[model samples]
Target: MFHLLDIKKHDDGISFDQTVDVKAQLLARDPDIIDVDSVHVVGNISFDSGLYLLNYDLTYRLVLPSSRSMEPVAFDNQLFISEVFIEEQDVASKKELVEDDLVLILEGDSVNLEDSVVDNILLNIPLRVLTEAELENEDLPSGESWSVLTEDQYQALQEEKKVENNPFSALNGLFED
Candidate 1:
């Protein structure tokens, strides 16, 4: 909660440290995230040069599914928020000049950082969650003819294919001349 008076009155600004349970909200957005253990937010909301600066550190613990095994993996992500909040009246002028992701407009009497924080959370979600336990198990889906390739394996394969594809490079001079 950003009280209009609190920020304008305190030069040093107000500090906030709280745990907000947004498990339901998280689940609604992404079903792959089984549970959101907790969301911790700590920051200072201060006024500077006609703009309200919100600098906060957001951390959340989530239970996600492993990429390969589909097992639950605990993931802790930390996101730093450096956002500027402007009054709604100022939005028309400011919005045209600014990028959408960086600044948030304060609609009414106060502003809420929840929406921005949630947006950042969405941006930070990893495409795949792999646990150490999963990595340690050398048995990663292999058959007699085919096997799961490690990241390095696929990279090496691409390099080999690149070289193989360019085998006729020495004959290029024939066409150039």
Candidate 2:
């Protein structure tokens, strides 16, 4: 947390470079995350034009279950974020300034960087994640009566089904006679 009063007093702004352990907090928010490394945040908060601007670069390693398989996979992430912080009373007047930017309305006298870090981490989670071996293997999973197929394979199968199930297919012999 960055105290607004302290930052506003300094012309150059307040800079922060630290490692934060948010594993318990993150796991509480999202049960899907298997584990996470300590988060590194390096940036400064500058007060300008009646607003506090936050700029930071965050790095962390997150472990999550694979999309195809349930095995845990580690993902390293580096992200840059710039956000505007507005006080509750100023939100209505400063809506235009924040419309085109990422902004957070401050509920107190300090800025919650941890919450921002957590939110961004959740947003950055990939839709699909595969293990190293899974990437190398070309085979899709299969069961006794059902099998996963590529898009092209599925399209071709659908075409074959259309031809096979055509009601007019049975009338072809009558027309030939």
Candidate 3:
């Protein structure tokens, strides 16, 4: 946590560059996270016109279960984020700033980088995680009585079924005379 007063006093900004290991904290929040590397955050926080601006680059590696195969998949994530923060009491007064940008309301007198990094990490988790092998494989999984079908394949199958079940096919030319 960085004190707002300390940062506010700096004319330029307070720069931070460090690697923090929040593996335990991350695992506690998400059981699906199989592994996590130390997070590297490099950024600056500056105060300007009653608003605190935070700009940072975050890099980390995460191992998670594959969406389809449930196998562990490693993801190397790099993100650049910029956010505006306002003191809780000054929210009403800084309404214009809030309206102009996505402002984070400070509950206390400090900024918590770990919390922000963790939140962003979770939010950025890919919905579909696939390994190299999975990406190369085109065959869909199948079982004894069930099989996965692509959207186009399913639509074609439905049309074929409708045509086979229709009873008016034999009388199609009867009305031509």
Candidate 4:
């Protein structure tokens, strides 16, 4: 929990350089994300007369399921998150939310950075993660009736299919025959 007192005391804002743990919270947010080792945040909180801003860099590691192989893949990600907090009173007074006006509304004086931290981490995770060995091995799962294609083989097949499915190919075939 980030203390509200610091920002309240310092007009210029307060600086924070510390690490926090929210492993349980992370799992609850995303089931695919597991084993959240640690979260290191370095930044501060400041507020102008209009809005309060939280700017920080989030560094954390978690295990994610590889999009292809469905195996566990670990990622150490560094992300920069900048978010503005709006009080309920401001929204009631304002007309509408505009583009580039995304905000986190505060329930009270103190704000919990954990949710924001996890959100950025999740958004920045790669859609696919392949180990160096996976790339080099060129191994694919094969069954009695079907086989999985490697990245290279899949692209080659797509190119071949495009040529075979050409619209004028039937005329070209008749002439050849």
Candidate 5:
């Protein structure tokens, strides 16, 4: 839940501060998240010409489970803002409302600010994810599961496919016919 503020009419430029609640939502979505410490999000955002621009910095830490212990991972980066736009369009047949509607557009360097948040979260994710020892040992009921194939397993599968579909084998069949 990223805070959006000061979205009102002002004679001068509008100013607002916000704190994005990414960590809490992420953990809630994935209970396996053991720790999410020191997540920092800093950015400057502005709206102009029906668009929003955001430049930002992100830093965070993630903990992943291993066979013996949890592995700590860190991420730090800067991102540019690109585009932010309003999501409203007037219908041809509908009567115009008394109050004027304001739409915000986001693009270019400002768009990077939004992308930075998502990118940082993805970067923090473990390429090889595992559960803690306690969860691994527990006998849980059957449900949907997701896992990554190891390098060796993927290579072996590819090799097996190659042998089954060799071009030379097809040539031999053609000659026999």
Candidate 6:
């Protein structure tokens, strides 16, 4: 279960804690997703120095029996306390909720950390759910292959290859004494 606590008013700021059932929420919201095994979430919200910070960590496992080409997705990530800002108005009305800023920070090795950590676990959801057989089958070419090079390394290699094959190399050789 995944839960988010509502912000409570305090002299300097607000603080709260909550736990939510993610699988049930997802199932209720979107019937297309099925076979959710379990979900666990824990976090806290605190306000300080005119800023509101929400820190949360989550771990979940899902079953995608419908998918035929991919693996069943499981994930874990942490949301760090980063920044906080306030929005004076929302699309619904002109009234403001709080006077402080709200900022969220997320750090992890998996993709969609920002979404999971900031977006309240909505964006981290797998686009396509897969079953056990789908996950085990090696013949399926569904997901992207992992890469080894950093951006800098890739750029450097490209530059080196270009210089080695440059057409001007022939001109330089012709001019050689």
TM-score, model 4 to reference: 0.77
- Best candidate according to lDDT: 3
lDDT of 1 by residue, 12-127 (tens): 98899988766776778877778876699999999976688989999988788898888888978888988888887776667654565556767777767676667678778888
Could you tell which candidate, 1 or 2, scores higher by TM-score? 2
Q: Give the least accurate 10-residue stretch of model 4, judged by summed lDDT.
A: 92-101
For lDDT, candidate 2 versus 3, the one ahead is 3
Candidate 5 global TM-score? 0.43
The TM-scores of all predictions, comma-separated, are 0.75, 0.86, 0.87, 0.77, 0.43, 0.41
What is the alpha-carbon RMSD of candidate 5 to the true structure?
A: 10.5
The number of the candidate with the highest TM-score is 3
In model 4, the Cα lDDT at residue 82 comes to: 89
Between the candidate structures 3 and 6, which one is better when assessed by lDDT?
3
Q: Cα deviation in Å at residue 171, candidate 1?
A: 16
Residue 52 of model 2, lDDT score: 93
Which stretches of model 1 miss by more than 4 angstroms?
A: 92-101, 142-151, 158-177
TM-score of 1: 0.75
Model 3 Cα lDDT, one tens digit per residue, 1-177: 789999999989899999988898899999999999958999999999888888899999999999879999997999997878899888899787778767988888998888888888998999889888989997778999999887999999999999878898777889897
**Model 2 clash tally, residue pairs:** 0
For each candidate, C-alpha RMSD in Å?
Answer: 5.4, 2.7, 2.6, 3.4, 10.5, 10.6
lDDT of 4 by residue, 1-177 (tens): 555666667897877887888788778877887578869999988876546789998888878876667778787878888888776677654435423467666788776877777777767877767665666776776889999886889899999999899987778757665
Model 5 gets an lDDT of 0.47
Error of 5 at 26 (Å): 2.1
Which segments of candidate 3 are over 4 A away from where they belong?
96-101, 165-177
Which pairs in model 4 have colliding backbones? none
Output the worst ten-in-a-row residue range by lDDT, candidate 3: 94-103
- Candidate 3 clashing pairs, residues 3+ apart or interchain: none
